[model samples]
Target: MKRFPIGILEFLTWTIALTGLFFFARVEGPHAGLCPIANLGLTWCPGCGLGRSIHLFLRGDFLASWEMHPMGSFAVLVIVWRQFELLYLIKKQLKSWQTY
Candidate 1:
C-alpha cells in the first residue's frame, strides 16, 4: 500500500467530516420537531439547522438546504474550496503527483 501526502490526508479528513455531517443532517425522524433554541430564548445558533441543511445538500436538494440553513452551505463550499486548493498546491509542488 502506498502512503499519501499530508495534503491528501487533509482532504480525506475534511471529506470524512462532511460525510459524518451529512448523515447527521439527515436525521429527521422522531425528534425532528425539537428545538432547544426556542426554549433557550435565542433566535439562532450556528448549528440550528445544520443537520437538515446537510441532509438536504447530500440529497442534492440545494434550494431546500439553503432554506434550511445558509451558513452550512457556505461552510460546505469553503471546505471543498480549501480541499481543492490544497490539492492544486500539492500537484504543483510534487512532480510525481502531477498526474494526480
Candidate 2:
C-alpha cells in the first residue's frame, strides 16, 4: 500500500536530479552554487558535458548533443526506460488493487 507513494516519490526524485544535472552543466565555468563533485575532482566528470548536451537537445541539435557526450544516446534511453518502468509498476499496482 505505502509502496505506491514511495514509488511515485522515487520517480520524482530522479527526474528532478536529471533536470538539475542538465541545468548545472549548462552554466559557464565557476558557477556560483555548490557542486562538490566538480570541485573535489577533475574538471571532467561523467556528467561534465551533460549541460551542453542538454542545451543542444532542448534546441533540437541532435548532432551537437551527441558531440557533447558520446554516450548521450544511452542517457536518453535510460531515462525513458526508468519512466516506463515506473508507469508499469503503477499500472500493475492499480490493477491489483481493483481486483482485491
Best by TM-score: 2
* Whole-model alpha-carbon lDDT for candidate 2: 0.68
Model 2: lowest-lDDT 10 consecutive positions: 24-33
- Candidate 1 structure quality by residue, lDDT tens digits, 7-75: 878878988888887775554564454677755868776677776787687778899889888876787
Candidate 1 regions off by >4 Å? Answer: 1-4, 30-43, 96-100
Tens-digit lDDT string for candidate 2 (1-100)? 3345336777787688667765655534654535567778657677766656765665567898888876766676677689879878877787778876
Summed backbone clashes in each candidate are 1, 0
Error of 1 at 5 (Å): 3.1
Model 2 residue runs over 4 Å out of place are 1-6, 18-46
Compare the candidates by lDDT and give the number of the best one: 1
